[model samples]
Target: MRLPEVEDTVNGPFTMIWSLLLSLFASLTARSVVNGQTPAGLAPKAFLSLPLGTVKPAGWLYDQLVVQTNGLAGHEHDFYHYVSESDWIGGTSYYSSLEEAGSYWFNGMVPNGILLDDPTIQSQVQQFLDYVLDHQDSTGWLGPEVNTTKPRYLWGRYPFFFGAIQMVEANATLTDRVVTAFHKFVALANTMLHNGEGLEDWTRTRWEDFVIVLQWLYDFHPEGNEDLLIDTMKQLKYTGDPWEDVFNETYFPKTAVEDLRNPFPVLTWHGVNMAEGLKALPSTYRFTHNQSDIDAASKGWDLLFQYHGRPSGIYAADEYLAGLEAARGGSYLYQVIGDPKFADRVERITYNALPATLTGDMWSRQYLQQQNQIAAKNMTPNPFPEDGPYSNVFGLEPNYPCCTVNHPQGWPKFISNSFVTTPDQASLVQVYLGPYTVSTMLAATGNKVSVSVDTLYPFSDTLTTTIKATKAFTYYVRIPSWVTNGTISVNGGPSRPVSPTNGLHAVSVHAGTTEFTLDLPSEITIEERPHGSVAVHRGPLHYAFDISRSSRVLAQNAQQPLAVDLEFDATEAWQYAIDPSTLTFHTGTPAGGQLPSPIFDSGLPPFTISVAACPIDWAEGGNTFAAAPPTDPACTGAVTNITLSPFGSTKLRIGEFPTFKAT
Candidate 1:
């Protein structure tokens, strides 16, 4: 089915070019290299991502990262065979035929460790890096797949190198070793791609990742080998899936993939692939300088959400890109295009969808999460076309080990990318609102800026930012599109209504201590969904019916009892249709000035909304998944006051509900 062409509203060709020129001007004048090197020859990015560890989690956000540190993310390698004894680290064991599980762990662990500044995790990462770097083959290849005869897939190395690059950026001491190793691997990759040796189906479809790392190397540590790097990018693009063409032509799928005919385009429809491939066209534009590539990138983004988007800000992809899954990719798009809409999308995913996948304590997670998940148990005859019965269950490995390792990247990357510098290095851009601190030097002004944000954002309406800089610089704070009447005040001065330019409100600061408070008023919003159902939102958080739940421990690791796989079942009635007319929002402070160790835990969001609702006969499909809310659900019980919590805080939830008239 041909999808109607979406108008280029947010990132039209003219807007894209204008943003690029502004970024380019900043790049040429800025002296700050704190966020690593700016684009060398490629298109100038609107914002330059700071090196990992430059931005540190603080306040409640810090507690969340600590929860992750004490949970599965920090300890998966201790007993999980995939990471403890994998081929990537010289063990005989393998996650599968392909040696990617270990790489996945490394990729996530690198940022998790760096952001927390956890010495134990940093040491573990260092040990693995030392081993991988020391074990480079004589053929200039990395990893354990060096057989010239059999088919070798290069997909795993993309994540590994991506993590390695972050490590180098965070700790410049590892620069020489990492740069040398990558040069060797790039040489071998050039040879392999030329002779058609290592490019397999997975590699061909997901070549943008390889190109991204190549661009990183060329910009930062090319070692006078720029031609080799650019040539490799061309080779990869030539052999890879034509994502630009895919989005530009009528080849893109317009309907749910499962609804389409047989012989599905598995490569394009795969959920994870689609999430990763969203950046392909924009990535290609960096090299090709083609305006259509940029246009297609924006058009593909619009089409994706139009056809497959969920209220939680993610699309459905239970393995295929059809229904809701906890996967997102717009931070990169925001950086590349400098569009607030991209940043807004990332904020939505982070606040609503990402946390929905993981247990509140950050221990276990689901392979697939739904917008209206009623239960977290093994489901037979489920909606997922390619996932197992246990896909929605919260456990150590739910349906697959892929999410177990890959989910760690979600929060850590969000924290790392929350604060970035404009290309000119003269201005600091706060792309996401959160409790964090940024310490970096601005290249243009040669000033050291340290900003500490203190607040329980999304839960609370205000954020207090404290800035101490050696020299004056401009600070750009992102004003989310959700805010209609926001205000900012400096040093307890009279509040002034914010007038944002391109979704960012800029404030100039002096050389010494400066503090400002931004208050973005929150209002309860009712969003009408398909069927007569409605979803509620306040700020970035999606509110849900927090049905009381009970947990049953299904399995536990023998060695580490803390590592347990559990399933949650709703204990109380969950079929409630809300009365939006009676909704009331409430707020409070943490008990003792310290947030809960796991801030996402139930009943700890510091805010709640009470609304009148009635029991409705919402049907369950496949004996597992909650069927869509009925078009005209009838009240089955008397209307009673019900409390709704942030969607991220609940295990068993009704995020989308059918509304009914009350007599």
Candidate 2:
């Protein structure tokens, strides 16, 4: 079938046609191979993700998720106009034709509600799910866009079903209904792609989202329609942007988008697109089983970080692929490839970059957070290529509504992916450390096992994991690559140094409740930055010089005053260069002898690092962003001791600092 001709400025007029033909030929071949015989080169995931609500947050992590529940994440639909009147929820108000704002909220809130078991959030989510499921078009299309003549974009459905899939996983009652609705939608989607109806710029660029959903259906509930699903996945891949080619050194932009030559590409340079595109090759590898796809995925990740990475683990992209902005995608990579570095990278992002973008209470967030950020107010002529002046401010929708609704998934999804089972379900792997508990039946032993991890990790170097099971099973714990001198002890036994294989330490556990203590000894490590500057790291947490700041409400919602936009200005001087030699770490007990409820609050961390710093003449970029630290910066004032806190704990902070000799 000849598909509609869509303009393809990036790859030229013939690219789409060629891709469609190639995909058609490939799908036919795959169907024949998959019909009676197993397709060759199908890659297997090292770890399989447990269903939603499998892992529940505990300790300080529980407090964090609770804060999110009470904050904007839970209440966005109550007041925020975008979500409150979203098209997906039977309202006309929406940010774009894609209707992403509501879907983003749904995607994040599903895991958030299910993980917390928060009835309030769960009810809110259920309403949307009911509307979408009940209101599905006779043609199998979802959402309010049911007009046949007008063009249909499948992009929004990707995120919408992302949440719906989770809801099905968490609530058994919704399984048949959700799955049935998806089957219809998939059937229609397969036809739409064949006719080239929804293959526009944004949808084309982010086709991986759709492919992921199709792959999920194929794996768990094909329902005798495996060929249709595989055909749709192939069509989505070929019709979508060629991400693997884009990430190559020849095509990938080495410098910032503004610095690149004229005729700047839209999707290629977009920050969010780059982030979503990072998983494209990996997603393709599952079906293609091509080794080059895997190689490209890893290489693309490295290239992105090497050129545009910030101290906080996220690379830059205010709107375009600018020098430094906050984003995340490592969890999917870790699950697919089982690369220890992917696990390490996701941990770093969760501990450092993710929280730094959010307010202490998770109510407000910045659209653009920088590693060297010292102010959270609007800035004119900022570094971002396409963002407005208010991009850096802490607000409901600072520069765009995307981040506001999208940021909620960061914490909840991280917690969901924290604990996963090996492919055979013989062993439960603690992929990352956090305050969480997992209860699952081991398929290998046919016994239920529950593991509870209690610790203030990334803040404290020690954690206690207790395993309870009816039968013996193997347990794998990830010892982060940063830990060089770590030890583990089982049930008061003599401590032994942790020996890791590919960043994981395995332990054999006997039935009926066993406990293990892991102590990861950490020290201040200085990583030199571009200039004669440094960023501090100890274990997973990144340390930053917390700048004193005062905030004022910029805008407030009349319906709910708590939903307000805030502008934070640094109250005290922020130009300080630290002496790495004098950095000292300190820890103490909280007043209640427990970690603070809102541990991410500024000045609330139980642990602190004191470093001697001298006032330096650090210039500001357009009266907002701090410029790169000068080479061998001279001290403007006497060196004084300053307290450094976890990067996530400070909204206004100097995470990257110039260094000087302490004389």
Candidate 3:
């Protein structure tokens, strides 16, 4: 079969006969490729991801997840099942323990399991898998029979769909079972949609979630004859509100800047829904290949970030699209399109907002994290649009359990997608800076390449990648636009300056082993945010003025008996303003400490900086932080020395600071 030759602007269109022949040729070629493994040496521009466990997290990334394993992701089953009433392994609730188990398996277990082989992680994963495989009904559903209570609510099965997909990606042995189950589920779902059985509101808006699973199956299904996949997509296509329509209008951008405080209409306001909604276009685009679909996806992101983006690079989703507070949305976008901007956004959020939202031990997390977050306490009229009063408080399921289960995905997914293979597997795309080892087959020569990266990135700017390949291949490294002085040294050769275009630096290497060192020097730049407040950033790491803080557990067994929730009280004055120009920085190395272990943690950070500043009179009140830094606040006291740490390092910090004139 032949594909219609795509013409450039200068070239004219092809004849109808030629187009038909080309289409036939392309279809046959696609069947050959998809029915088997995608042929090597057919590299596309970007966005094809490597399989799970392709890269093993190391150094800071590894340690961060270790802390997580000690916390929620590894042992949530000890407290309760995925759903509330269900016991340890299975439950009747459609979305509880099952959801948590699936996400934990995909995000936590498969990717990082080999690195940190904790018994609890291993045991729980096996338990969940055993239960799921054993309980799967003959018709294809993994849990619970169709009941009168929630008949036709297809949303609960999404976790199983996603989790099963990851299992197949991680271990091909599970593909047959997973695919068979999904096929059965889809058959049932198609009937329901056709008959209008039990499509709940969430099932409608969250239909894209189902489409995502179908697209994944269509792309990688072993048989590759998934005409049923097309049918499933059509069934789900009309379920959700037209996200493109709303995003195209003034709704997002207008509300983003003007009324960030007001609640959005029900359809658009939900945070997790918005995050999941980002996939609506790309999921559809995969089926239709319509340029408009891809275009709409990009436009949707632009409006989301333009109006609602937080300094941490995550959009605020404190239950709703709370535009200013940090939320988890960007990384999902990065997964869809291998855009370096999304990678950088993920890094910023992973380094700053992500860790800050959770406690040092990863025991608890805040539902909402503001740039100017001064205090993290429970409030009656909380800052969030619809979250509970304890939304800002650091605790297990403080506002809602969604974040409790969903938050674990942030770090693990970043690790899995740190580096991606181009579609044809000819090149490797370094999406984020981190220490890891990548092993994959290079399409250029059909030989395997293994790369190990060493660096204390985000905290430090230097990275060293050592590559061993059977044959030479190209490596594309992304250098952010903000980086001015970036250079790369090949095999200890002369350091050459790299002028990154569109945030990429492509290099060709010779066959055999080689080492490349990259040096990126960060320049401290202040960004003006909402209400004229300034945020300090060096590289991807956001810096904040450290405030003395004390914490007390407000409720024990609050959400569950084993879960402990804590509220923070600011011990020192938090309303000081500093002059950006007058700021002087002092660097310090590892201070030996016991608590906040693994240098990345706040108290024992691998590096620390002290800055000179003076206290200025800035007003502070309300359940939220001061709306904005006071305009020209008067100097309140003598100049003082204050320490500034990475935003992630600060449990109670003032990241967005008020600037005052020097006396």
Candidate 4:
């Protein structure tokens, strides 16, 4: 199923170059790109044209190294120092960004960088890795609980082992001690998975994640086990997303796909999180081809990304449920770092909502939410399994402390990734914004190119970059698959067409000038995931309507959650380009037209509609959730005012956009 061509009205040059980059990406590695999905590379393989970018790549690798790798805010090594982080893979904090981080670590493959680079931090990371590896039994299992502690647990040990190796590889540059340490850990991890009954801890489905990592390790260190590598992928295809309990209903309730005795635990999930991961089985299958793996991964992401794409480019997590009425659990940490589609999503969810939970300077509310569902701090003296909101921004208590420590990795890495160019000769300018200075480690010369970028971006369409190269080579630049009239030129000559007319994943490059100009036309268009669910968008920006209703009429003594007025276009103005008779979106809005955006981003604004409301999980100062409900925080009796606020504004509020249906 070919995607329809969107119009290229943004800017011509920028559009051309960007398209070229993405096209090259598609042509070279579309193997990973799912059929009917956009033509973009899901991993760094696409950036081969520029080796510098490939080896080092663009993004928070630098900042993440500085903060997370160096052990900022109590995170010694690997994800965090605690066990209870929630909302994986997106955001700046530690434990708070788990789900996404575990997944990202699998593909981003950057953890190895820390293993050898920071001696102090590496020791800490190695200690954790050593603990898991050494403690494993010969039957192929490692770790204390198979990683089943709320958000932090539950993950199979394969990814953790994989991350340990990745960190070792990256840090090996500094010391062979890193190599020996990682090798020792890998030996134990591999031994446990292959021969030990420990593999039983996780479902047969998660076997592939271990296989994938093993494959990578074996590829780099042929001395590693190959049998475990193949067996895991094989098992993953047959068994999918592992289950916590077969008989349990409340926790692992029989919902989405019941009837079948063994359903989900088949190496896939029900939404985009699982979709993109499993769909690539074909590419991975050849090593040991299994169509089932690809099928499972594809189906899942398709369902969620299509139905749950919030206005912010993120597939909203209504706590695993889909559609508009769902609550928000927006986290980019799980979104693959190699793919920037979710980078935009990460930006959206992390910026506004993530920061809103913190102090003005980013320290306060421990629990963060897109909806007002949960709005309390992680109360101290809280017990594990009893304390909910694994990682909140408020002060770190003993209970759910993962996010308190883990969430710290989000912001700095986001900033670093925002300006990516690794030891490889490649470059990926993830977002369109200004004030970000990008520095790339050129693979061609083992040198660096300092790029001072200054632009208003989304606000304006021009990006001015001062590229100071350490060597001369064909340097490529990206053109977001979305830009229409994008153009780039080295030293302001003239822009040439480098890519297709329309698409968000695109790129272009010039020969040798130090200065360059990238022009983008604001051909704002709304995008939708499959299933016809709409998320209002303009380029990478997802907009939302802050409903001040039930709270205030605006222009008053406003408490938290800022207030503002918005006017619609009146002429073609909000008018539908409809057949009129059909009453469909016709040419304008659709059933899900006014769909709300997810409010969460690394450095963006928060959307707090009103503090007047509360989520299902609520305690004295806020909301709480417990897998085991008997100990869960009880909500105060509702009565007078239940208000909603924008996702970005309120510390104690609900989503700015209330649940609404079109008139």
Against the hidden reference, what TM-scores do the models get?
0.90, 0.92, 0.86, 0.54
Off by over 4 Å in 1: 1-40, 85-89, 94-98, 146-150, 261-265, 324-329
- Candidate 1: tens digits of C-alpha lDDT, residues 291-327: 6666777888877777678777777776766633322
Return the lDDT, model 4, position 522: 41
Top candidate on lDDT is 2
Which candidate order results from sorting by TM-score in descending order?
Answer: 2, 1, 3, 4
Best by TM-score: 2
Better of 1 and 3 by lDDT: 1
What does the lDDT read for residue 93 in candidate 3?
48
Q: Please give the CA lDDT of all the candidate structures.
A: 0.76, 0.78, 0.64, 0.36
Task: Please provide, for model 4 over 1-663, each residue's C-alpha lDDT reduced to its tens digit, 9 standing for 90 to 100.
Answer: 111132232122000112344334323432333464422211322222121122331222233234333332323223332331222212223322233333233322233333224455445445444444454444333333333444222234444644555555444552344344434545555444345323332333344455445455454554544555444443343333222221123323223321223323322333323323432343344353334433433444344445444444344432233343323331121222233343444556554444454433332234324332332333243322212443332443222333444455444344434533322544333343434554456554565666666554443456677666555443334455556766765565677543432223233333333676777664434443222222233444443333222211212212212211111111111101111111111112212322112212222232211112212331222223211111222333342222222234444332222211222
Residue 76 lDDT (model 1)? 83
**Better by lDDT, candidate 4 or 3:** 3
TM-score between candidate 1 and the true structure: 0.90
Alpha-carbon shift of residue 298 in model 1 (angstroms):
1.5
Residue-by-residue lDDT tens digits, candidate 3, 1-663: 011121221010000112344334423422323334433221122467777778778777788889888776555655644532245333554454443334433434544454465555555555665566777777655564422354536776676566566657767887777787777777777777778654766666677778877767666672553666676675676544455554664555444332453222254556667766677766666655555655777788777777677776677665656554222115445555555566677778777877878787787788777666667777644555566667778887776676676677777777877787666667777778888888888765697888898887765667898888888667777777567678888777777776455566766655898788888887778887665667777788778876778878887764455467887877887777777875544444433322235444555555455555667766555644545577667667887767677878777778777676665
Judge candidate 2 at residue 381 and give its lDDT: 59
Give lDDT: candidate 1, residue 581.
81
Ranking by lDDT: 2, 1, 3, 4
TM-score, candidate 4, is 0.54
